[model samples]
Target: MQIVILKDAAEVARYGADIFTTQLQRKAGAVLGLATGSTPVALYQELIRRNQAGEVSFKNATTFNLDEYLGLSGEHPQSYRYFMDQQLFDHVDIDKNNTHVPPGDAKNPITACQEYEAKIAAAGGIDIQLLGIGRNGHIGFNEPSSGLTSRTRVKTLTKATIDDNARFFAADEYQPHLSITMGIGTILDARKVVLLATGENKADAVKAMVEGPLTAACPASALQLHRDAVIVIDLAAASKLADIEFYQHIEAENQKLQAYLASL
Candidate 1:
């Protein structure tokens, strides 16, 4: 895993967006893995701006969202499908038919989970995946203790996760305690992964993910085994990382090396 420490949230968003932009530029039809949450919204906005500016195109690309609330239909205001439509699909030239979010209203959720995995396989696997870490270090609703090699499946949300997300629902709104999410193994299958986090609230999670052991306690740590996983965070989120300065040094040296190679 490569840890990239930046100055602030806006810089983190731009850096993460540039990774996606480069992937799409290299392969317009790349299958993208997406995540939903406040942290990724800024990155999505940056992508939208690039698309509108003719810097990139999603016209031929296909997308799959990481998870969805189990009891909500796509039309539900709180569903991830609706979120993506409003935040991205609607603003880009991508074909709506090519976008896929796990079926939240499936009669047999188990079957739906299996089908979701099959669909990803049929798409030739994800070329790049975007992610946002929860305060507790959960990724894609795979809370603590999730199997390191688990696959697409229905999962029960932890109390902490539910409480953290409670703000999204109205006081009397029906909030789902269940979700369908891609497993840690599933996310690790991506050719490349970019995880973005910001704010002081995420400091501890960032520290654990970057320097913690490869244990299920922090699901995001599974990325440690991935050959190409990039963790992008602002200084606020990166505050608790013990070796922050070393991470910054590595990033600086990497930039210099890239510049040297480019000039040659």
Candidate 2:
């Protein structure tokens, strides 16, 4: 696992965007695994800027979103489908036919999950996956206790996740109790992964993910086992991490070393 501590959320977003753009450039028609949430909003915005400047083009790229709230229609404002269209797909050149979000209202969600996983496989697998950690360490609504090797399936959201996501709806009653998400094992298959977090509210989770033990309780900690995963966080979110300054200083030194090597 690699950690990058930025000065603030905006910097973190730009860094994430740079990473995304570089990866897209390396593979123009790459399959991108996406996530929707406030944390990644700025990164999407930066991508939009790059698209407009012709620094990058996503016209040929394919996208597969991380999860969706079961029972919600795609038109629902709070649904992941709506969120992605509003924040990303609509703003970029990504082909509508190439983008996919799991069906929230499928007649048989279990079969839907299997098909979703199959589609990912058919796309040649994800080249890069972007993630955001829930307050309780859930990824793609795969709450605590989710087996690391689980596949795409229906999951019951924990009370904490429901409460945390309640802000998106008009009332608590509007929040869906169930969600469909990819399993950690599926996410781990990606060629690269980038997880982003910001704000003081995320401090504890970020610390646990970066420095705590590898336990299912902190699902994000599983990234420790991934060969190519990077965690990008703002200073406030990284505050609780031990030896954070040492990590930051080392990163600075590495940058200087790279620059010196280039000059040579």
On lDDT, the leading prediction is 1
| Model 2 / residue 252 / CA error / Å | 2.2
* Candidate 1 colliding pairs, count: 0
Each model's lDDT: 0.94, 0.91
**Candidate 2 similarity to native, TM-score:** 0.96
User: Candidate 1's residue-wise lDDT over 144-219, tens digit each?
Assistant: 8999999999999999999999999999999999999999999999999999999999998888888899889999
**Tens digits of per-residue lDDT for model 2 on 1-264?**
878999999999999999999988988998999999899999999999999899999988999999999999899999999999999999999898999999998999999999999999999999999999998888888898888888889999999998888888885457789999999888888889999999999999888888889888988888888999989999999999889989898778878997999899
Model 2, position 76, has a per-residue lDDT of 90
Q: Relative to the unseen true structure, what is the C-alpha lDDT of residue 222 in candidate 1, on a scale of 0 to 100?
A: 89
Model 1 C-alpha lDDT versus the unseen true structure:
0.94
RMSD of each: 0.8, 1.5
Once fitted onto the true fold, the runs of candidate 1 whose alpha carbons sit more than 4 angstroms away are none
Give candidate 1's TM-score.
Answer: 0.98
